[model samples]
Target: MRERAVQRQDRLLSLVRRRGSARVTDLADQLGVSPVTVRRDVEALTGRGLLDRVHGSVSWPRRRDRPGGGRGPDAEDLVLGLLAPSATYYFADVIRGAHEAAAPAGARLVLRICDYRPAEDPARAAGLLAAGAEGLLVAPGWRGPGDQAAYSDWIAELPVPVVLLERSVPPGGPLAGLDRVCSDHTHGVLLALRHLTGQGHAAPLLVARADSPTALAVREGYAAALRALGVRGPRPVIGSVPADRDPEGFERAVQELRSAVSSGAATAALVHNDVDAIRMVQRLAELGVRVPRDLALVAYDDEVAALADTPLTAVAPPKREVGRQAARLLLERLRERAEGAGGGGTDRGMGGGAGVVPAAGAGSVPDADPAAEPAPRRHVTLLPTLRVRASCGAGAGTGGGATG
Candidate 1:
């Protein structure tokens, strides 16, 4: 219901912005809502200065370009475009963080949702550009390596500055030199393993999917993290699908973990995403196996981990911070371009904001040279921390640190 309300309000704002002003009755009819509801929404928007409520109508405030306008007094009106796969679930917080950062900067964030239409991404970005977007923050839905290869060329050729949000390209790819902000999944896997190992459990088995980039990262990171921790055991990783999409595949994953636990071959496990983890715990419970008793468990993504019956101790990637930093970087790039200085600087390592180190293997941050002017591109990596809970035999404790 809350999501629906947000969508409706977004539509209302877009309509008023495009039309300049709209009668309350007309807005109600166009939005498929009652006049009372439209007036209530208008009142809320007016309070925020997003709309000016006149007699029986609402207008996009004219003072938008002046001091004490809807924007900050010292800020120039900046328009940014955000293109993402979906607005709900994990991307919801990402979008919220971008908005929170953009508001104080007096920037208007325009969003484009591309669902089940990977081929339309370039076209959608063009539309955002045509709508007067000065820059773009894009999260392309690249299902595999092939998808990246197919989309990287045009994405690199976009006219405005672009920031890859929670996405990265392989080193030497067309967009490899572009600015990107992503959570270091390798560090996230390390935190999950260290926490489980500190609790006297051997290397936990991994159950993850290969359909998405983050899933692939978790699967590969699990092995690397295990080796780094110097904990050696039967390190078997299984595959899983969304519980609703492929029940049989999910059941096979659960049975694999069950076999490992029942035979005392494994004592702890990590699941890629929270939804799959929660469903696994529920199914395991029905089979007479309990979390933190029969098998200690950790889940990744931390999206809804805490809501599980036995709250899950999960690795929470710095998702919101990634969005914030990515937007800030793009804004900075735009400011530099506006100031007549080309986008180049003394290897401004990630330290300018958060403890963002350059992402290893994804791309290289050029070494600072005293003779040369400065290096322009940056690939920032944020670290994820572990949230302890009942599922991992820890009682509501924050156990992991950001530093690896």
Candidate 2:
């Protein structure tokens, strides 16, 4: 606790030094703390003569002999652009994580909601750049890998540094050179399958959607996990959505699950996304099928999965952490760019946003090779863990961690 408080104070000092002066309310907001906490820290710094109180604001005690007399040139005042499909849903946590990291480092986030409009992403990003976005964190609205891969060319040609958030291109594809951070849905699938199979359930069926990139990844991962685990039987993949979106499709999924269970073709199932899984459970209940009695189930995306009547076991992706790491990576990219361009006042000495290391994930470039200079292009992939619950017939902590 003491260490964290000290670190926070150091960041507080850095921000004031970089900007020359900052309001107390703005400091609290930027630090992601309360006004009282900021006031306390300010008082402590003022006692040491490191800061000067000026009305409702604070300033560095030292004076400047010339203009631009701060720590480094353009160290503060970074405008980072973020483009996501939606502000709600999963991206909300991602945006919050990015904002939390950006604010403390004196960077402002400019968000652009594209609402799955892939064709409009470039235009929106270009507009952000025109409005003085020095760096970008973009989660392109891609329905699938192919859809995102198609837009790689334009993304690569953007003048400013770009870091992909929750999105990536194929290996050796157009955007391979770009930095990206995303959840390892493949590992997420592996977690769900291994958990079900660990309890002696073989060849669990998969009911998923193909409408989003995450859904597609889960579908593909299910196939690979089955082959890897050598669990053989009638493994079928059913496509589905919420009941209201497509009643016929939803009915087909429920019927498929019912048939599989009744015929003893499968005794367990893994469903992608919480909504579909929850709805499937509800419809199956109407048919007199009880979860964990006749069919053990696990759902992907822990969001609201636990709210079901059966309290679904789920594979939880690190959504918010993906945003934090992506933002931190973009800040580093900006610093590197500034330094390479001979910006003497660059924030080279300042610790990049939040001082947190990126979590390792799939396709991640290893950092063990000290001789590798200039840092290889990163594809940081965060793994997902399985949350055990009643639906999967698991007792407390029966599921495995991400490493498992």
Candidate 3:
């Protein structure tokens, strides 16, 4: 901990030890902190069994007090449980949006980082439900190759509603009844292709994640975009490169991308995810192949895409809006379930008024009264916008010329 923080904490403990208890205002006056800060310190110290909070005052932990505390089920105000593999990148904005929407909707959106599972993935939703989460907002769990279930069946067995976030639901796939909110990644591929081809770059290589749930949709969209544009050439889709946590794999992928552009296998490429695109852009820079000058590039997700050395042209999923919509969608369901339950929401004690869901969804004012027209359904497929920048060779002066 920082020295100042330790000093403040120490001062707090010392005061409690000396006086038996100290009022929050008195500690704040002595410690150069606000009463709120003193109270927060008291709370933390109490959590560690270093002190006890005694009605606006703090005292040394009593013999009756045991820290590293316990929370009964009733203490859990967790209404919606959100789980995603990584905390940063694409999901951060999603989480932010979820929180923003959940507050007005009167729901507490609890977050859990889905960590690496040794034998099997954790019961991501069940544990949340056990902790009194009313519903779940989970990015579809990563499964093995060819294990094709869009929204898993096991989630159906769980008693709560499941809303898949930022993941695809295959057409004619299972879970017709499931609620999901995702950016149309396939449409993003088409957008990138059209942008590149419109600028006279024919047969650009498409890089993608082979083992991902969204890969099939991306590949299908690439081919469809190629055919729809009537562009004729040996269209290449490279899936040998991976999108994983390993830096080595990303570096190898970068080398592979560099080789493709350097050897003239493809002058331009559209990579599905931005992390690989950033690494590839750095590698290409190292190889003295300038983006938009030697190799035109486009990334699917815009997260950190613009931060590339060349400021990559990318198709960015509206992630925050997706998150906002996901929350609204879940709340809409909760609302309907409320109506179905004779207007008293199932978890009456949970959200009170904070979880009051807006009827017209995230971006609009309600048209028909929520009671009149049907509450908005939960499934939402948000479209992506193509961000034209230096890397794709489609912005301003770069638009007319692609090195091929």
Q: Name the 10 consecutive residues with the lowest summed lDDT in model 1.
A: 346-355
Candidate 3 displacement at residue 39 in angstroms? 20
lDDT tens per residue, model 1, 43-156: 876775567888998887675544432232225556788988888877888888888788788887888887725687876776566444667888887766467777657776
All predictions: root-mean-square deviation over Cα? 7.8, 11.5, 11.6
**Over 4 Å off, model 2:** 1-74, 341-373, 396-403
- Compared with the true structure, what per-residue lDDT tens digits does model 2 show for residues 12-89? 877887787899999999999988999998998677455789888998655321254323213555668898988987
Point to the candidate with the largest lDDT: 1
**Superposed Cα deviation of residue 98, candidate 3 (Å):** 0.9
Q: Candidate 1 has what TM-score?
A: 0.75
Sort by TM-score, top down from the best: 1, 2, 3
Q: Estimate each model's TM-score.
A: 0.75, 0.73, 0.67
